[model samples]
Target chain A: MSGFDVGGRLKQLRMQRDLSQRELAKRAGVTNSTISLIEQNSVSPSVSSLKKILDALPVTISEFFAGEEVSREQVFYRASELTEIGDGVLSWRLIGARRPNRRMSILHERYPPGADTGEDMLEHDGEEGGVIISGTIELTVNGEVQLLTAGDAYYFDSRLPHRFRNVSDSECIIVSANNPPSFSDGGDAQHHA
Target chain B: MSGFDVGGRLKQLRMQRDLSQRELAKRAGVTNSTISLIEQNSVSPSVSSLKKILDALPVTISEFFAGEEVSREQVFYRASELTEIGDGVLSWRLIGARRPNRRMSILHERYPPGADTGEDMLEHDGEEGGVIISGTIELTVNGEVQLLTAGDAYYFDSRLPHRFRNVSDSECIIVSANNPPSFSDGGDAQHHA
Candidate 1:
């Protein structure tokens, strides 16, 4: 946490919302002078104080801490720039993992034939939605299942428990979105192909 | 707003935050029975009451209204699925336009050599970030200019006026993300190539 530009980031956050220091201070329950002081890097605010201010922006402490990580991350990603994770059966290419406070998880996911999301149903936070760019995928959500084809799409509550399977004899490509970004987390499972 | 499934959407919104009816009612400063009646479609909620309920989830009325449109939309998009706009100089492929309360704008952008983002600089709300997937392009942000090649990325506050130009001899491919999903919505311009 040393050398973290808390002031600069705070200013950026405030500005991102188009909020003035006075407005933000009011929202954070802090004084205008405190906001000015913090932005000027004059004082090292306590974690609690910082949390109070940050909560107004609604960013979590984890994301606040991860802000530095995003600064070191590249602004753009090409095909080779994607963070790739695969289980020999499926390939997940994650985009924009370095964006600070990423509110969305966008992935280029590929499932080879006969691949299944293991024996257990996959469950997680947030909602999951995707469009089938190619091939066919059998999607099961909360005991309801369907075989989706090219151009088919599904959006569901992730907490309902779901499993993705490529039961056909071809590869499937999906551009999937997960709000609040459930990636590299438990959502990527060791599948049974 | 006739035929709107306010109850179902309200229930989904409450469940999205993993909040129980009792808890959400408390947050909205309303009785649990009010929430129940609303969710059960027993009564039509006043706009003000609905606003109070929606505010607890921190979603805008516009987004809440847009929910029905999203439900009527497809989940997947092929190349043909993308909503495209360009001026013969650049091609922008917008993804996931149908998603409700879209928090991210993901674009597959192509800039032909000599293409530029117009004479006037571009400014918008939120941040803009993308990677140079292929070829070389010159970027200018707040008068700071640089040339980026494949794998090079930039992320900046979009409030700082910026411009893009492909001065190279070949075409350029980029994957750009705009937070809060600015698309088909004035970012496109009659760019001079």
Candidate 2:
């Protein structure tokens, strides 16, 4: 994923979870400045650091690495240039480099074995569509738990409370899209309505 | 752009244009069966044919080629793979192939001499944001016309009628995005409120 794009995604995710920067920092076991810098793309988090944050968000690192895009023409991106977001077990990558203002942000997410969004469910506005690329995910939405395997797709209103966990021993990979980019750097919190 | 995501995009664009398989085939001067096959992903449009159809839509061929995800680490696309969408008069590519579910879709549009939307201004829902990658674009939103050159940016409500035309002799590329993935495959039309 584009680093520039990650700022928006991070903001979106944070908002979806109704997390203030300070709140997220406190829960993720990180400093407010660390989250702020990471969200601003000023500092790229180490895999371990990212994992801790995802652990706090309850998102897995493996699920964070998967992202996607479709271009009119073929373009090339190098591995060294992958846009990394979140913590280790819940790291993510934006698929394209030069994408500017894309309507939707796709993400490749890696959920480590036993890692999850924790006991808390997350709810937000807009719509969410996702497909499990690999492994197994135990999804609880609106008080119902659904176990999804590879190739399974689920779409729901983001406003509904939800949580994801990996019950399998192996890791899980999921390809997902949010109607609005959700991740953001901790900036302009007071400015948000 | 990620090829894996193209299936949804093709469906979305066809819907947004409000052109059916038969209608699109008629507009592109192709057989209806061919359109059906392509939409189904049963057949890939050749360079020339794809270009002709996209030109009718006024989208550049580069978009078709540029939006594909190749691997887990980085995006790798080649120039040779660019699908020609415009008639050498305008070119465009979609960014954020990995993050198709983003709030807006970003497009890299190149306008050649005398290229324009060739229709009345368009008014739609959502917000439009763009940056001029190079050259110039004569943009008319409602009754207001603005000349945008490289490094210039624009943001506007899409509900205002808008159109873009290249008044310069050289090609102009624009990086643009709109929220809510406004383009659709006409599936929504079938629903009755």
Could you list the chain B TM-scores for each candidate?
0.61, 0.50
* Candidate 2 C-alpha error for residue B17, in Å: 38
Q: State the TM-score of candidate 2 restricted to chain B.
A: 0.50
lDDT of the candidates, in the order given: 0.67, 0.55
Q: Itemize residue pairs with steric clashes in candidate 1.
A: A75-B154, A76-B130, A76-B131, A76-B153, A131-B76
Model 2 alpha-carbon drift over 4 Å, by segment: A1-76, A96-102, A185-193, B1-193
Model 2 per-residue lDDT at A82: 40
Q: Which 10-residue window of candidate 2 chain B scores lowest in summed lDDT?
A: B70-79
Model 1 gets an lDDT of 0.67
Model 1 chain B: lowest-lDDT 10 consecutive positions: B184-193
Tens-place lDDT per residue, model 1, A1-193, is 2345768878987886789988988988989998898888777674456657877875544345432332333444556767777767788777666554555566678899998886688876555566665799998877777888865566655666678999999999766666546764344532221
